[model samples]
Target: MAVRAGLPRITARVHLDLLQSEDGRRTAAELTRRLKVSPASVSVAVNYLVRHGYVRRERDPQQRRDVYVIDDEAWYRSVVLSARQTLETARAALASAEGAGPDDLVGQRMARTGAFLERISLDLLESADRWRMLLK
Candidate 1:
């Protein structure tokens, strides 16, 4: 659902997840087998990710089979950027209400909502750090 809302196609995220769990970059045949999807569907999704800069493809030197690599940094950045945008929008709306008048009931509610968004943004940022730490 999140991938559908973002720049990456849903299948791209699935492919990325699979590649990350597996030892090496995956071939279309392998992906088709693992995902149980048609070759055409996998091709379209891979092409979309490649075109959108979320993945890169390379041919194996020995076998000449194409392998798709997930751009982990790009994936991380995309998620972080999205989280920032969501929090910023909430903050902006809250700020507008607060600026109208602090004593207003709407302003008070907005202020509370703003605090909640800020906390959520911090937690999300921290989660990325923790994820990286676990990898280490």
Candidate 2:
């Protein structure tokens, strides 16, 4: 499911494992051991997840290690991030269409694409809000 959403296979697996964890959090070592992958591989996957707002890294001060977490808010954050990115792309497409001129067939196509993306982005943003409310 995470892979279909654009995560790499290993990263998706790591995310699924974390989601199934009792506390929605796991240490890097635990992830490596559970997934039967190298520590480096776990690290890379978690790093990618963190960067993309799917996970957060917290310092386990007592254990002197990092714990990766995917809390309820993670989904909301990810959706917002994705929506914003899509909206930015839509804006760029629309601008490009304007630069291409009104009579250009390619420009018309670009305009339509931009409108579609903009609508999808707005819908995602609205859905995220509704889901967030339900989660709370």
Candidate 3:
């Protein structure tokens, strides 16, 4: 999925699995074992996330290993920003139809579509807030 999305393949797996896991944190070795991928692959994904400000590296107090943690702000910003972009695109589509005939079927459909997109965009934002509360 990550590769298809133009991101490193192991990135989606490691990050999703780690965040879904009980502790929501994992060492490189743990990710390697759980993902059944090479250490290099895990390292590549972790390094990318670290550089992108999406993940943080923390030294394990008891073990001589680094644990990757998801950056809440970064994740939130990514999702919200994506939703914003989608909303903007929908708005643009509506703007393009501004001069269309009022009785045109396509214009009416576009208006409905824009309303739906706006509603879904707001819903996504609300859902993000709810998930953050759950994490807290």
Best by lDDT: 2
Once superposed on the true structure, which residue ranges of model 2 sit more than 4 Å away at CA?
none
Candidate 1 lDDT by residue in tens digits, 1-136: 6467664464755556555755546788878888777888888888877766566888899997888877656556555766687689778868877796788888888888888887888788778766764333
Q: Which stretches of model 3 miss by more than 4 angstroms?
A: 1-9, 20-22, 47-54, 57-66, 71-79, 99-105
Count backbone clashes in candidate 1: 0
Per-model TM-score, in order, reads: 0.59, 0.90, 0.59
**Per-residue lDDT of 47 in model 1:** 87
Give candidate 1's root-mean-square deviation (CA, Å): 4.7
Q: What's the distance in Å from true for residue 129, model 2?
A: 1.4
lDDT comparing candidate 1 with the true structure: 0.72
The digit string of per-residue lDDT tens for model 2 on 4-113 reads 86788889989999999999999988999999999989989998989888789999999998889986788789789989999999999999899997799999999999
- Residue 54 lDDT (model 2): 79
C-alpha lDDT (0 to 100) for residue 26 of candidate 3 = 85
Better of 2 and 3 by lDDT: 2
RMSD after CA superposition, every candidate: 4.7, 1.6, 4.7
How would you order the candidates by lDDT, starting with the best?
Answer: 2, 3, 1
